[model samples]
Target: MTVHVLEPACDWRAADVADETRWTLELSPADIAELEAALACAKARAADLLDVTRDDFPLPSLAPRLVEIEAQLIDGCGFARIRGLPVERYSDDDAALIYWGIGMHLGKPWPQNKHGHLLGDVTDHGKSGADSTSRGYELGGVALPYHSDGSDLVGLMCLRKAMSGGISTVANALAIHNELVRTRPDLAALLYEPQPYDYRGEEPKGGEPFYSMPVFTEHAGRLFVRYIRPYIEASQRHPDAPRLHPKAREAFDLVDAVCADPAFNVYMDLEPGDMQFVNNYHVLHARTAYEDWPERNRKRHLKRLWLETARLTDRPEKFRNFSSHWAQKRTKSELKLDA
Candidate 1:
């Protein structure tokens, strides 16, 4: 098979967008006021976070900007951040409600785990990385390697910052894919073959402990990627799972090498009230390990959302709502925090 390079507009280097303005939006005072009014409207109606629709939390003015942001995520840059939400002015629940409302404007909420959490929490959950069933988001103080989540879009809204570290890192997977195809088509080609991933114990009852899907797929002349090295590595623990082919191993290593190169990745410090969103197919994200404050209120926390965007209508079948099997067990992830 002949592997072809896809030079999407999102093929940006860290230096190309290091100016921040290229990818970050500092909300204007009017924008903030508009959000406040929207929040008030949603609250007045006593809307449940999960039940809130775009109509429920109206963003009359900011809605247009969100549409452009969605375009940027899918076509231009593959990632973006909206800063200045005045989170301290509201309680934790209120802040989360606001995050959920904004997320509604971008896409439909997708379940993040077996619990079918439309909204999830990212913080220390006391799970060890060594635990086979533990997902990276549940564990803390450890670096999460570059990987894409199980959705078209993934978002995080910071409510508090850690005492140290925890900087967010995003790598241009599109650029990495094109580079691999240009220099080493043989290795890049292998990635299009099916690769096994562990279910992390989320498989339906009596189902396989692991499943297989390709890391790179092409559909309707667009490139789509679903790469999570840790999960792929963990699948090896299942005897029934297919073994990683030697060529595939080489391909995975090349992908990892490209992601680790500073030229392909950019780091961002997410302060409280900042929200970041990334197109899962075009970008792979990670984080630095960090220490947390002892006080519950001071500990780092970020509200998380896995979204299905209308802008990406041509995704491969395998990547669409892959978590629906877990949706029957719907629930949210909550952390006990100080008020």
Candidate 2:
């Protein structure tokens, strides 16, 4: 099978983004004051985060900057770090309010997982990565393999840092695609074919326990990739799931090898108050194993949001309006913030 080979606008190497100045946006003191003021107003009105709108938490000064960020996420490097939120001064609830408010300007919050959780907690929930039903975010102290989230964009706001390790890494999948096309076009072609993926126990009721999606797709002159090696391997447990093709396995390995190379990955030790946003289609993210503080208050924690951006005019049919999980919509539920 042959695939169209086009130069992706998001193609970028780690060296190209090594300078923090390119992707890091440090909020000014005024920006912090504005955010705090909005948080205060929202608190005063007892506004629920799910109900809060951009108009409710206005960012007169930061709104334009967010628009710029939206552009950068789509047309530029596909990932960014917004630093300086003074998270230490506020409680986790307050910090989440601020993060959710900021996220409002970027895009509409989509549900994370089968649960209709517009807001998600990224702290470890005692899950094991080795378990077929375990989600990486729910498993603590384990290194997450590079993978894309099911959303147009994914954002994480750091509330606490781990005692050690847990550095976040992002790789430019567009660059990986370009490299594969240049070096192993045959393997790259295999990626465009559908591959089986385990649903991780979130399978639709009365439906198959697995689903099929291509690792790479090109739509309207754009490159889109959805890769999760662990899930693909786990699908083998289901007797009814189609077996993975050997060529597809080779393609997965090639992509994994390219993503692991330092030449393609940008590593960042996310600190308290750091907010990171990545275009899920163009970037693959991972986290290193970490040791957490014994104290619950000091344990590593981050709030996450999966957003559907208005910037993309077109996307693969499976991704449109969260169609991939349409059959499982009845199971939608939101995760509550820990007290």
Best-performing candidate as measured by TM-score: 1
Top candidate on lDDT is 1
Estimate TM-scores for all models: 0.97, 0.95
- After superposition, the stretches of candidate 2 with alpha carbons farther than 4 Å from their true spots are 324-339
For all candidates in order, the CA lDDT equals 0.89, 0.86
Deviation of model 1 at 109, angstroms: 0.5
Residue 28 displacement (Å), model 2: 0.8
Where's the lowest-lDDT run of ten residues in candidate 2? 327-336
Q: Worst ten-residue run, lDDT, model 1?
A: 329-338
The alpha-carbon lDDT assigned to residue 141 of candidate 1 equals 83
Q: Per-residue lDDT of 161-187 in model 2, one digit per residue for the tens?
A: 899999999999989988888899898
Q: Write the per-residue lDDT of candidate 1 for residues 1-339, one digit (tens) a residue.
A: 799878467788888888898888888899988888888888887746676778988988899989999999998879999999888998988888889899999999888888889899899888998999999888878889999999999999999989999999999999998998899988888888899999999987899999888999988877889999999999999999999888888888899889999999999999999999999989999999898888878888999999999998777777786545876755667675756
